[model samples]
Target: MKTLRFVASVSFGKDSLAMLHLLLEQRRSLDEVVFYDTGAEFDCIYRERDRILPLLEERHIKYTELHPAEPFFYQMFAHPVHSRKTGGVHKHGYGWCGGSCRWGTTYKNLAIAKHLRGYQEKVVQYVGIAADEKNRIGDKCYPLLDYNMTERECLAYCYEQGHEWLEDGVRLYDVLDRVSCWCCRNKNRKELKAIHDNLPRYWERLEALEAVLGNMKGKPLNEVVSCS
Candidate 1:
């Protein structure tokens, strides 16, 4: 019998890293590792990527970097829908994404999943949903093998693998969460505040997109957000 062909979606976060570590422990051979990048991601993300590159190099893991066909920021400005909210800040007018409304605009997340679907053989996608965040793990459209391990388990796996120095003396269990774009709607109150405080220009642009749309009360994104 042939071994299963699997692709591990690596986010360079604790959960995803843990999933990869678990696979390595099982002595499984991964066909590939996929990563999606939207141009608007944070500088810290790039630094993290730098750190991840050597780790992948050490492990000789094959990975692919997939970016959007169209530039996300360019599309944001070219369309009228995203144009109107150009400079406003604050969640009310600025189009910041949160729990109720995600701005319906996560290009990278879905794009990565879609790209994974095109592989030649049957693919088992491994997602980094934590045990504490069971709700984050959902019925994926394609074939998926999910493991909802806890944050503690994720860090412990890394520590067991001799990555204690990489933990940066930070409490791994508490700091094992993923980092994403500053203006992303999936963020919590603290994340939003951090964006509003640090990246005012980006925050303003998001607000402008929302102001242009005018319906913050759970309306369909198609009606409010138009690519044209």
Candidate 2:
């Protein structure tokens, strides 16, 4: 029988990197390292992706960028209708999820799996979800979760191996926690403030979206900047 092709999900962040490190350390023969670029990714993520490419190159690992079609939550909102209270506005907020639109997790994740349907060999999909993020796990899964390593173990292993690069200086204090779309409802107000204070352009774009979609109601990032 032919050897299977293993896919390590890469997300320009510490946890994913650590997972890759662990896989390599085990001498596992992986065919590819894949990243699902959900266009809504943070602006800084592009640069991080480049830096990690060389590492993959040195290891002869094929790195692929996977882009999703319109985000999976396209059906969440109705067509924009001008409202007297909000004035002429676009319904941009329709896609924003609260606890109600839990679809955010399943939809995007399934989309990512759908995007990776090409490598048909027996496959092992390495997800970056850590043991600590219990809430982040879901019912829909890749079938290979049983053999996967958790984020906590990945980090400790990276540290023991002297990988300072994994120390991604982001506020989450994790090298492995590479989250996308700062405006995501899954993120706390502190993370949102960080985006506003550090990446002004992204913050402005999100604010303008709020104006059109009115999803945030009257609450603005400026109001909670200090707390974050």
Against the unseen true structure, what C-alpha lDDT does each candidate score?
0.56, 0.60
Model 1 C-alpha lDDT per residue in residues 68-107, reported as the tens digit of each score? 6666555444423434457533233224444654432466
- At residue 171, give the lDDT of candidate 2: 36
**Among these predicted structures, which one has the highest TM-score?**
2
Candidate 1 segments whose C-alpha is farther than 4 A from its true place: 1-3, 80-106, 139-148, 152-178, 194-228
Question: Which residue pairs collide, candidate 2?
Answer: 14-175, 14-176, 15-176
lDDT of 1: 0.56
